[model samples]
Target chain A: MNPPTPRPQPIGRLAEATGLKVPTIRYYEQIGLLPSPPRSQGNRRLYPDSAIARLRFIRHARELGFEIESIRQLLDMADHPDQSCADADSIARRHLADIQSKIARLTALGEEVSQMIAGCRQSSVRQCRVIQVLADHGQCLGEHLAGSVKINEK
Target chain B: MNPPTPRPQPIGRLAEATGLKVPTIRYYEQIGLLPSPPRSQGNRRLYPDSAIARLRFIRHARELGFEIESIRQLLDMADHPDQSCADADSIARRHLADIQSKIARLTALGEEVSQMIAGCRQSSVRQCRVIQVLADHGQCLGEHLAGSVKINEK
Candidate 1:
């Protein structure tokens, strides 16, 4: 005979098992990344073993910096095990390229800021290189930060 | 006698001069980065010459990735030119460190993704290295992206 079905888990238990916050799991469901699970008589969500695997896949993908949409595509491919893995490979490659470009931009920005600080005389604000360069963009070494580079917030 | 007062310009002119969108200019005003300008008889916002300089300062600081609050502090320091520029130096130093850290994190993440893609045999989804590593975190090279890394959205 076939093995007995594994008991379904409540949302809390599923969250604990998946190492995802409850809100994040809910958000995934809201965003349609996670399928809506069957609910119990008391209206609590009940997840089966497959749900556990799916959530783990999402969490690990997120941890790896996969965007939500990419995670959705990956999930779709995972569900259809017979399909070719070309899309998955392409997505990973694209992500790697994106990360590399960001690294380049940040490196340039870091150098500019570093140089600005290095040139600071630490005298009055009027003579401060940091303030002077910021006040007059013409003083910048280059237009390295001309676009929407994600400079860190204080 | 002092030079003739520079004629006041409207919001649109200010936007054109600063290369900032109208909504962005309004947002800066709302956030108190740009002080509210007096309105004309028709209720059009009229900005003085001093406003142009202040808006440019805000725009440059934002392009360099300074947070709004930090810009406010910088503006205060700029207004008081006699004060020591130690705060500006410190802020630039901190931002430089932040960018450096992000570069390191992104570099690690890129390597992991690169390795994952490299190892992929381009076979069926069932055996795909990209999918496999995402499904199981244990397969990752390291915990480089375990936290809130800003992976790009598709």
Candidate 2:
């Protein structure tokens, strides 16, 4: 006799199995990242076993800082196992480049802030190098740190 | 006769002088970073020359990646020139530490992504290390990248 079909797990079980918040799992569905799961008789969301792997993949990618759009492309590529992985390679490489660029900028920022703090004498605010350097951008090491470079708000 | 009073400049001139967008200037005022400027006879905003210096200071602090709250503290310190600069020093040090931590996290992420791409042979997605590593978290270098460590989403 054929084996009985595996039971579909509820959304909470999927969230537990994948280490993703329930809202995040729902959000992934809303964004079309995850397929809409079938519902039970009571109208509760039920996810197939395969949902665990897919959600885990999405969570891993997000942990590594991939944007939602990029994650969408990655998931699409993942769905087709026989397809060439050149697109995935490109996305990963581009993301790596972005990570490296952020590291470099943060390095520069760290150095500049370090220098300002080091130059401080703990004296009055008027003589504080930190305040002085901030007041006069011309005194900065370079203008590269001037505009769009923002530290992660989190 | 007393010297003539200096004419207040319009919002556009303040924007031009600070290299900050008009909305950003208005945002600073909305957030109390900049004092509200007097309106002209035609109801256009007219800022005193002092606004330029104040705005420049805010811009520089922001360019250095200081938080709005931190900038508020620094501005408060700057306003009181006779105060000790210990607070400014502490803020800079803390910011520097935060930048360093981000640099370290990004470095690790870059390495992991680089290794994944290097292991890929341009083959099918089924054999792709990028996909394999993402699909199976157990195959990753470590669990540290599995949570909160996000590459700058920008």
Candidate 3:
């Protein structure tokens, strides 16, 4: 177990402790996802040890495919640990729905793209099935979105 | 179809033609993804008829989930229509593989989130299954990643 190295650490140390880049930590603060930590006498940002858990919570939420705005709401909900989690549940449900829809669209695209590649026999562009399929969406066999697939992967 | 208007239209018309935003057309030009079009005597951008095909191709490639860099390669290949499509095929195959991996990850996350939602009975945050599932990775039931799910929606 790491000895409690004298409470607060610099922003860089905080980043290192959380496996997050320095810029990302600052960006989180800038976006109000993370509260601004106190500053040292030399104008250096000093974050308390508690920041680690907060940052980790945000990071973990992001890894679970929650969008930034959804994470903000989740963070807010988590702040009031004793309140009802109905909002949290709703947010999770919405995120889950979005992920499912994206998966469905991607799965269909995967099949169509796979078929396009398989159909192509390393021929010239003139005879390239992949090119033809992309050039004309009507050639696709799947119902996957050829004109629109609303997804924001971040 | 209506008769073609006098040779060149403004950037707005170009955006309308391709269903791209005005700024996005500018961004494409800035990124060298789309070639700069000729300007009129008043310094307004004037795209020739060929620009429509070029922009549509870029948009279609994007809808197919090809990354910007892959789209660049595809565009370059399209420039030389007489060339073999081996590169295009490889790019499409690579993109297809990426999309497949992403779908797999999202599917796992979707299930976990759904379970968290299903297990919840609209309880308080203290006893909230969804919050517990997110806050503590060990609560996950499936082999899905609780600490990591690499995907972005946009």
Query: Which candidate ranks first by TM-score, i.e. highest?
Result: 2
Tens digit per residue, CA lDDT, model 2, A1-85 = 8798878999888888988888888988998999998988999898888899999898888777788999899888889989999
lDDT of 1 by residue, A10-55 (tens): 8889888987878878988999999999999999998889988899
Model 3 in CAPRI terms: which quality?
medium
Clashing pairs in 3: A151-B153, A152-B153, A152-B154, A153-B152, A153-B153, A153-B154, A154-B152, A154-B153
Error of 2 at B6 (Å): 3.5
DockQ winner between 1 and 2, please give it: 2
TM-score of chain A of each: 0.88, 0.89, 0.88
DockQ, computed on Cα atoms, for candidate 2: 0.65
> Per-residue lDDT for B1-154 in model 2, tens only?
8798878999998899988889989999999999999998899999999999999988888777889999999999999999999999999999999888888888888888898889999899999999998898888788777555543343
By summed lDDT, the worst window of 10 consecutive residues in model 1 chain A runs over A145-154
lDDT of 2 at B7: 87
Query: What overall lDDT goes with each candidate model?
Result: 0.84, 0.87, 0.80
Model 2 chain B, poorest ten-residue lDDT window? B145-154
Worst ten-residue run, lDDT, model 2 chain A? A145-154
Position A106, candidate 1: lDDT: 72
Calculate candidate 2's fnat: 0.81
Q: Mind giving the per-residue lDDT tens digits that candidate 3 earns over A7-118?
A: 6789889887776789989999999999999998899998987788788777667767788998888878777878999998999989888898888778877888898899
